[model samples]
Structures are given as C-alpha cells and as structure tokens.
Target: MFAVWGLIVLAGIFVVIRFTGLIDHMLPAGDPPNFTFAPETPVPQARNFFIACPPGRSPRTDRAMPSPSFDATAATLADVMIETAPAHGMQLMSGVPGGKPGRLYFLARTPVFHFPDWVEVEFILPEQGGDITFCLFAQSVYGLDDIQQNEKRTRAWLADIVGRMGPSG
Candidate 1:
C-alpha cells in the first residue's frame, strides 16, 4: 500500500510538470526523433511521433506543392522563410542564411506539449537557372505521433510564405 501511494505521488508530480510547461527547459538542446532532411533517416515506431515532407507524399497533408515552386529566387525564398515562419510562432534555430540554396532550421512550440517540434528546410537553386524548389521536414520532438501538427504547421507556413511573396510570387 505504501508503494502504491508513492507511485501515485510520483505520477502526480509528472502531471504537474507537464501541465505547467516547465519540462521543456530541463531537456538538452537537439533535434527530435524522426527529424531529418534525408529520406534514409529512420523514424522510430511510437504513438507521439509524426513526420512531414516525406518521400512520395503518402500522407498528403505532409506535402506542400506551391505553383512555380514558390515563384522566387534562392535568396528571396530564404528571406520569405526567415521572415514568415516566426509570424506563425516558429522559433528559428541556428544556421539560417546559409548561402545560396539556403539551409534553415527551426523549433515549433505548441500548447499540446512542452517538448519542441523540429523543422528542417532546404532551398534548392538550379545550377543552370531554372525554377527554385524547396524541401521541408518537420516532426515531433518526442513520442510516436504528433497529431498531424507537423503537417498542419508546414502547410500553414507554406501558405503564409507564398502570401508574403505577394503578387509576383
């Protein structure tokens, strides 16, 4: 009976910490599981994990197809991402403005959990001067499922970026 009581108390503390949003600070800095820019990056099977911008687009929500591939140059597209993502509440990580064909990273925070969700973006500029394209990968920082948060976020952010690019874009 005493052990049971102790277990209950521990569980209570865990709930409190999670609810108060205090657990995010104690975690070490790094990308979450299944967070990768490469297709070979393995995703662990679990309930709290989710990944967007996958190969072949099996999960359609994870995919974003912008007409004219965003209608901008490598630098302009990178600027769009840098300028627009934060408006949607994405906190930019390091390595932004990484030259042509920009490589940007960010963390997406949600009220659903205290852990961070990771988003990796790469802008591809044509060597011979063609349409600009980009790839984005987003996934939960923890758990097996993200309730489609990554997908939803990527879609919304893409729309916002396109909008920011304006009439020319």
Candidate 2:
C-alpha cells in the first residue's frame, strides 16, 4: 500500500511541475516578427550578451545575435534556405503557401524531443544592387527554457547557410 501511494505521489508531482511555468509556448511571443527589418516587434533582445528572458531565468533568449546578412536576391536566398533546411535535419512543419517570395516563416522539429521551434527569415533588397540583409528570428515552442537547444540549432543552421549560400554581408 505504501509503495503504491508513493508512486502516485511522484506521478502527481511530475504532472504539476510540467504545467506551472508562467509562460505558455503556444501563445504568440509578441507581435508577429518581421525578419527583414530591425525589431518592430517586442521580442526580447540581448544587451551585451545578456538577455532578460524572464524576471528570473538565466539564458534570457534563444535568439541569435547580430542577424546575419547575405548577398543574394530575396527570392534566391529564401529558396536556398528552404531547400537546405531539411538536409540539416529540420523537418518542415508549415509555412506560407507557395512559400512567400523572398521570405520564410516556418516551424521545424528538433531531433531529440521533436520540440517545435519557429524560424523567420526575410531579405531586404538594397538599392543599387547592393547586398541583401538577412534577418532571422528563431524561438522554441516551449518558451524561454529549451536547454539552449534553440540557440545551438540556430547557430548551426546559420553556419550552414553561410557555407552553402556564401552570404557576402
């Protein structure tokens, strides 16, 4: 009887801990993010490598810093990313139908937990045939604490982009 009681208590504790986090990942983090422009949304930003993710959590944000830039047309860059993302093990979840020219907003699953993470990429076409600025935003579906997996995944994919696309900026 005591053993059974102990197991029930443990299970109850586990379920309770899972739901009590103040933030829920299913809700929008803020205004729909715009990747091509500087933050017009209220998504958290990192200051001097410190992010105020929450009032108490330490890692702050899962977003990458100094949004990467590329020297390619928005259409071309978006094509490159969509094609290459699967090779990097990011299974596509969803995106704009016909894939939104020169921009992409989609969700992918992490391998281990199949955790969902959102990534937005957009390119700003500079005048005079200048380099296009690649702005990217990624966040985990489980909110602020993704065990740093979100950041790691973003960096790895960005490096892959640089290697394959050879972004000039």
Candidate 3:
C-alpha cells in the first residue's frame, strides 16, 4: 500500500514538472557562465573585485547591445544601501568610473557588526573585453552566512552593478 502511494505521488510530481513547463523554465538555457574575481592591479591600485552574471549575457554579443543604465527608482545604489545597510550598511565614500567602456569602482564602509570593515566593488563592462568571473564569488557569499544572508540580496547587487552599465560603448 505504501509503495503504491509513493508511486502515485511520484507520478504526480513528474506530471507537474513535465507538463507544467516548470522544468524547462527552471533549467539553464546555455553553456555554464564564468565569473572572475581579481584583486585590483596597480595603476588601477590593488583592490577586491568580483564579476557575476547569467549565461547569454556576456559582452561578446554581436546583437545590438543596449548600453547599461542605472535603476531610476528602488534599484539605485542609494536604494540598495537603504535596504541592505542595517544588516551591513557600508558607507559609499567614493565612486569612480573607468575610462573604458563601463568600469566602475565603489568604496564602502563595512557595517560595525560585519567582518572586513570595508568592501570595495569594481565592475567592468563586458564591452571593454572581459569575462564575468565574479558570479561564483557572489554564489559563495550567498552560501556563507558571514557575508550575505540571502542569494537574492547578492543578486540585487549584481543587478545594481549591471544597472550601472553605461549608455555609450
């Protein structure tokens, strides 16, 4: 009787996963994406940087790529800090854009409660010729409790970074 019930439940789950299109929608559509993490180099000055984005979103596209833009409303940096600051409110002391395509650097103060009392973010535009290597790091931070609590928050940061992509080249 138990085996029969288990089979029935399994069949139902399979039907929903297959017929409901959930499996197709949830599965990744392309090759695995690469994310890079590099310590800032001199000239650029040594600092921490990570790049994360989904597959098919690389800078190598021949398709007409739209210049990146910042979120006008809640997705703005200020909005993001407002949402993320209490748990890890870091002051954004300075921000500079790279001369190339869309590179950006941010200096932020670490919340009193968190480790590494300072965190810097440097995001380079794919158009400038770079691979996205920071996605793995973002995933790791989301996995670790000491860094970020939820992956969604990390994703928000990624979105904000992507949002900062420039309008030209």
Query: Candidate 2 residues 54-163, lDDT tens each?
Result: 12222224344554566777777777777888865664434544445556665665663355666766555668877766555565655555666656666777778778
Question: What TM-score, to 2 decimals, does candidate 2 have?
Answer: 0.59
What are the TM-scores, per candidate, against the unseen true structure? 0.64, 0.59, 0.26
Off by over 4 Å in 2: 1-40, 44-63, 92-102
Local error of candidate 1 at residue 92 (angstroms): 1.1
Off by over 4 Å in 1: 1-21, 32-68, 96-101, 166-169
Please report the TM-score between candidate 1 and the true structure. 0.64
Error of 1 at 21 (Å): 7.4
Give me the runs in candidate 3 sitting further than 4 Å from their true place. Answer: 1-88, 93-114, 117-119, 126-147, 150-152, 158-169
Q: Best by TM-score, which number?
A: 1
In candidate 2, how many Å is residue 69 off? Answer: 2.8
**Per-residue lDDT of 83-147 in model 1, one digit per residue for the tens?**
88887668777553332235677777775455677777666565675667666667666667777
Ranking by lDDT: 1, 2, 3
Candidate 3, residues 1-169, lDDT tens digits: the string is 9999999999888788766656544542221112223322111111232233334333232211222334233234334443453443333433323222122222232222122222333333334443322212211211123333223434555455454442223
